[model samples]
Target: MKPGALTPQDAMARAVAFFEHLEPAHLAALDLIYAPDARFKDPFNEVQGLRAIGAVFEHMFATLDAPHFVVTGRVLQGSTCFLTWDFCFQMRRFKRGQQQVVRGASQLVFDEAGRIALHRDYWDAAEELYEKLPLLGGLMRWLKRRARS
Candidate 1:
């Protein structure tokens, strides 16, 4: 309990606020909520360190239009938290104006210092993303239809 030290509760609140209010400018301040060597993994990328993690977010901003997260639910226990959210964005390449939503969840583990040590995202790339693409959408639908019971 030192001056300016964050408790786990504070860190969780900060993490949620950081994500919900994230903007390009906030990219420079990730260290406030993440450990220097925090690991972030998703269906498409796995990266460690603040710089690398920031790059992943940067890439998202670069490739997608109006990308944002809407937190739906959360569960917290000890140093871990699970957050379910909807990732909404417009595909810059294909569906330019239409907003796409991908339901996902993130498991965050915080360090003793209250900074996120690990962030792993769980989501189905095929059903959530690929099924919305151009040529791939049709193929994915067909494959799903064939697999259904």
Candidate 2:
């Protein structure tokens, strides 16, 4: 790690902490960590530009209850980093306050400034999200079983 520069580990750590403590107030602060034209993608949506990225997080807080990310592991290689995380939260519209955990990972690409250029998340939406819901959960589980050989 250099003296004043943001190393890959430092960036990952900062991101982990940021997500763990993220609130609606810190949406603007994303500009500090992500490039202006950054690309962010997950299983459900793909967005480019920091404002669009911020809107994603904003929607998360608006739609979920106390949503947070717990980073379990990190691997850094060159300008790309992979972070395994546990997304823990409760559904605001369904399942009430019961805790739900979605295990997933993210691929982060950093530029010369150490700000994220691309943030891609990989997870099984059917298993991690839909299968945890009430009505959808049952159908998802059934579909999973049907799809299995």
Please report the candidate that would top lDDT against the real structure: 1
Q: Show where candidate 1 strays beyond 4 Å.
A: 1-3
Error of 2 at 17 (Å): 1.8
The estimated TM-scores of all candidates read 0.96, 0.92
Evaluate residue 10 in candidate 1 and report its C-alpha lDDT on the 0 to 100 scale: 81
Residue ranges of candidate 2 with Cα displaced over 4 Å: 1-5
The number of clashing residue pairs in model 1 is 0
Alpha-carbon RMSD, candidate 2: 1.9
Model 2 lDDT per residue over 58-86, tens place? 88888989899888998999879999999
What does candidate 1 score on TM?
Answer: 0.96
Scored by CA lDDT, what does every candidate get? 0.90, 0.88
